[model samples]
Target: MPYAVDFDTVSTAGLESSPVAPALAGLRANEARYFRNKYAHVFAVEPAGDAPEAVDWVHHILDAERGIVISSPALEATTFQVENIRMAYVFYRSGLSINVMYTVDDGGKRAVGFKLSDGMDVPDELASFKFARQRSKLAGTIRGSYFVIKNEY
Candidate 1:
């Protein structure tokens, strides 16, 4: 059986009628952006699947588009038990893959952000994180949103 997790559901998964959701709702009240802060954050995240599966998705997406600032090559998963959180990469990167298992998160009033704390091990510097942020944001915009491997072209 397949589950249908749409943009609406996906964006509002952990958030609801709380002040947070309402605040987010208000931000987009009269604006037009593909995805607001609602689903744009993947703090120290697990990519909604197994570690290997997530890494594969990252590889396919980033490999096709090339990369941003990451010097390290290859994609790696920074796993988490929670869902819908976004993690970011913000520095020198290259061809490589490393998993940062633990990440520190600070959920702001609107946009959520995170920091890969000390002692935590990340496979790559963070180039992939940068890419993931952009990719996931676009992904969340697909109405009834979901990700599929585009290996067959």
Candidate 2:
């Protein structure tokens, strides 16, 4: 079952297994808010078990583009298209959120983003990328980084 994240009142219903459930939930809500505000799209996510394709796609991109593999288990994931952009998101138990933004048009913008919850340490695989901090009302302090996608997916 997919859950539509509520930015107004963030909850940890499906993310209870994570040690940093609150921060993770907040991070998820922050994403929901972004889509809702920017594109009038509802950001809904399903359990990783129910969204294997989305998770796998994200993993494949991470591994192929950066030679990176996340050790943490993914809790939830979603994939959707808005305008010309195909977007995918995977939230992990370690309070990490990864997003892939691929524009459908040739020569358009494409990138993979990583966002860490307030209290979690940067995972070993992502240590080489420098993360910049941003403050969010719902997610607190979020550390984020990204790399441009080189190969077509």
Candidate 3:
């Protein structure tokens, strides 16, 4: 079943196994707040096991673009299209969140973003990228980095 992320009252429903569950929940809420504010859309997620295609799409980009593979166990994921953008989000047990943003129209923006939850170390795969900090009431100081998509997927 899908559950809408609640920014007002964050929950770690599917992320309880993570050591940084609180921070992960906050990170999840941050994304929810963003969509609600910018797109007037609700951000919802389901168990990663239930969304194999979404997980596979992310893996395909990671492999093709950078030869990178994340070993972290994905706990929850969601894929949706809104306002011409196809987005896929996966939350890992390591408190890492990755999102693939692909614009539907050709020649538009496409990239993979990585956001680290509070108190989690930068994953080895993303250690080379410099993360910029952004403050959020729900997520605290968020460190984020992204790389532009190089090939069609």
TM-score of each model, in listed order: 0.21, 0.99, 0.98
How far in Å is the alpha carbon of 34 misplaced in model 3? 0.6
Error of 2 at 128 (Å): 0.2
lDDT of 2 by residue, 6-68 (tens): 999999988999999999999999999999999999999999999999999999999999899
Screening candidate 3 with a backbone cut-off below 3 angstroms (N, C-alpha, C), the clashing residue pairs are none
Candidate 3 segments exceeding 4 Å error: none
Query: lDDT value for candidate 2?
Result: 0.96
lDDT of each residue in 78-121, candidate 1, tens digit only: 33332333332211112122222222344321121222212223
Error of 3 at 117 (Å): 0.3
The candidate with the higher TM-score, 1 or 2, is 2
Cα displacement (angstroms), candidate 2, residue 70, comes to 0.4
Which residue window of length 10 is worst by lDDT in model 1? 138-147
Where model 1 places Cα greater than 4 Å from the true spot, the runs are 1-50, 67-153
Candidate 3 lDDT by residue in tens digits, 6-91: 99998889999999999999999999999999999999999999999999999899989998899899999999998999999999
Question: Best candidate, lDDT-wise?
Answer: 2
lDDT for model 1: 0.29
For residue 62, give model 3's deviation from the true position in Å.
Answer: 0.7
State the lDDT at 110 in candidate 1. 18
Q: In candidate 1, how many Å is residue 18 off?
A: 38
